[model samples]
Target: MKQREYYFDNAKFLLIFFVVFGHFIQSFIKESNSIYALYKVIYTFHMPAFILISGFFAKGIYQQGYIQKYAKKLILPYIIFQLIYSVFYYFLYGKSTFNVEPLNPHWSLWFLISLFFWNMMLLLFAKIKPVFGLVIALLLGLSVGFVDWTTSYLSLTRTFVFFPLFLIGFYMKKEHFIWIRTKKARLTAITTFIIVFIGFYHAPSINYQWLFGSKSYSSLAEDPFQAIFIRLFFYVLSCMMIYCFFACVPNKQYFFTKLGKNTLYVYLLHGFIVRIFRVSDMTDLVNPPKSFILIIAVSFLLTLLLSSSMITSLAQPIIELKITKLQQLQKKWSNLFQGYKAKLFE
Candidate 1:
């Protein structure tokens, strides 16, 4: 088996941590300017960087059964989670009626459906020259905003809006990432992050929803035509922030590095905890400044917990449609039990 690169793994773990942290602080964005700025800063890159990395690994599109493979991997889990979240929200919100609109993905589930689409898109987009493909993708992404109907239903908006990054990632070679890891790039990345954060802190009028890429220009601005420029600006900003994020990711492996492979588990499972936290009075307790430190710690711990073998083992069936991890975990416990029994008998 080929060895996994620690650099990508490190990048994934860090990005997923940011994803969790971003979701945790979202409830408090309205109450704290600093948190709001941080939220904007995070949203600018987290998902885009993730999508780019996802694209980077998508070089296997030509392999046999690739489409079928991802369909089972992404679509199956998306369906399962869509139903789960629907039922979860039904009970959590105590709604008058139960509704399951698979078209409308709940919260963070959009990534699954959109990811599948991005891979499918590579069938066509990958055929074009990289530059032309990217330009076409950008134009399509910008044009889609005018068609007000291109909302989040089936994640169509984001599928197009973010496809350029995905295409860019697909075209990227290993050497490109190696170049970003240079000391000069790291310094530039740190400076970029600081400047962006400060800029966001001062520019409260810049709506964070622009970073979401979910809404249409019609809804977000007075003039749809002008909003295209705003969306273009964000596309540029997101790409810059994405490379900056990549530049900062350490290439060395760490304790949490292996957990990066299980990010799907974290992405799918963390929602339950975050949703419950959002609805509960817990948000009131996690006020900004000092409390945010606690939120950060909790986010890291939550990411760690969800990525642990035990959680992955339990969730393997639903998420991966496999029990290999579960069986290993079961055998591990059985061995421990047998060892304890032998000790007692002795």
Candidate 2:
């Protein structure tokens, strides 16, 4: 197996924790001010940072067999999970349709679909000059208003908005992150985190749309020029917080490395648990004060539980299908077809 970067693994593990934490708090956004503020802070940079790290590790992704590997690991699992979530949603909400739309991803699963598109487009992105690529990605992201493709099902809006962050990671060097360990860099990073955390705490409930990157600029109903600036500001601020988050994270290997390795499993499986919480009215059933603390504690515990090795091991058979067997079966069918054709010609 290839050696792993401890820092990136650590970051991935923590980022997935934030994902679970954020989802858990969504149910309680109106229950507590502190929880709402914490949710905003988590949303601000979690996905951007996660995508950046993905791009960082995706060096040389276009190698001959990579597309095949991604199809098995990313695409196949995306389809399976999408179907699973669709069934879960239908049962929970009593939806009239069990539609599993490939183009329009279900909630949380959007990351998987977006990731697939990003990897597919890697070859195209590699052809552009870095400066030009960055400009185009930003412009396309902000110009979503011009396009009326909501029914496209391909997650075009998010794919464009988050594309720049992915490229930034693609261009990032190990030495770039090394500077964060320096005394001055540490001071600056810590201070920035303080300021941002303070802002999140005192600020009113933020329209999470700014960070979600899923809405069109026109839909926001702000002055066109002002809307453009808001998008740019969120992007810049997210980059800053992402760096600060990495700076503060431990670079040394830890027990969570295995959890990081199986982030895809945690990511896909945890949503099911969260959905159960929502559908059962678990959040509404609980009272404030004691129940609030219980929920917070449970959230962290759930995150840890979801990332545990036991959970990963138990889910592996489902997560990693026996594709080798399928490949052999396909080869056998092809051979039988060839034999039939040759015999007929003779």
Candidate 3:
């Protein structure tokens, strides 16, 4: 068996925690700008980093037959959870009747749809040179800013905007992450993260729609040229912070390692729980300091609980349909062979 790169697992654990934390903070987004600022900074690099890491691990999918299994792994859960959340939304918030429209994502579940596309597309991109793929992804990202139909449906804009990060990850070798392990690099990453946080805190209220890559440049009321530059800047900055994040994350085996393995479950299931809060108005923070501390703590705890093995074990039947189907098929074949053998002997 191959050794597990604890570093990647560790990174996934951290990113998933932030995903839950960020969603939790959305409840308080209207109440506190400071928390919103923190949320903005977290949003800036978290998904990009996650997608990049996904690309890294997704290396050689074409050769490895990984793509063949993605439908069962990603697509099924995406459909199941999308419908589940749709119903959850309809009843909880009284939106409409349960509806499952193609290409239209339900809230945080958009990542699954986006991931499905990226995984499938990477097979085509993998045939090209790394530099060429990177260029293509960057250009597509830039051009996506000009198109108005890039937002929402299927998360096309985000898929294109974040495609470069995924490409970069695909091309990165194991040695690329070596620098992050050094003491000097760790110090710099910490410093950079702190400085960025400080900037986020004092930064004026700015539209963060660009970071999500879901907005059209025209919609933002910026000229095409300026929008291109802004997108380029964010792309570079996000890459920097992604590297810094890899540097700062501990490379050792930790308790969260297992949680990292089951992130799909956490990512898919936690949304329902979070939605319950969103509809119940439980996330609203009335008292700033008191609510902030309590909510953060609860959110962190809830994230961990959702990612726990207990929850994963329960969800396995739903999320691991391929495994279940394979088991049933195996049993059916075994029974058939037994009957044939018995009849032949008789």
**lDDT of each prediction vs. the true structure?**
0.92, 0.77, 0.79
lDDT of 2 by residue, 1-346 (tens): 2343777777888898888878877887777776667677788788999999888877778788987887787777778877887888898888997787776788877777788778877778778898988888788777774455752357778888898899888878888877776667668878987777678768865566778888776776677778888888899888988888878777777766656766786788888888888767677777754576676677667767876656665566566775443465568779999999999999
lDDT of candidate 3 over 174-211, digit per residue (tens): 88887567889888988988887778778746667777
| Candidate 3 segments exceeding 4 Å error | 1-4, 322-346
Using Cα atoms with residue i matched to residue i, what is each candidate's TM-score against the true structure? 0.97, 0.85, 0.88
Models sorted by TM-score, best on top:
1, 3, 2
Q: Per-prediction RMSD in angstroms?
A: 1.5, 9.8, 7.0
Candidate 3 — what's its lDDT? 0.79
Task: List candidate 1 segments past 4 Å from native.
Answer: 1-4, 339-346
Better candidate number, 1 or 3, judged by TM-score? 1
Model 1 residue 326 CA deviation (Å) reads 0.2
lDDT of 1 by residue, 1-346 (tens): 1233888888999999999999999998889888999999999999999999999999999899999999999999999999999999999999989999999999999999999999999998888998899999999999888877768689899889999989999999999998888899999999999999999999988999889888888778648888888898999899999989999999887899889889999999999999999999877777687797799999999999999999999999998889999999999999999999999999
Q: How far is 95's C-alpha from truth in model 2 (Å)?
A: 2.3
Residue 89, candidate 3: C-alpha displacement in angstroms = 1.1
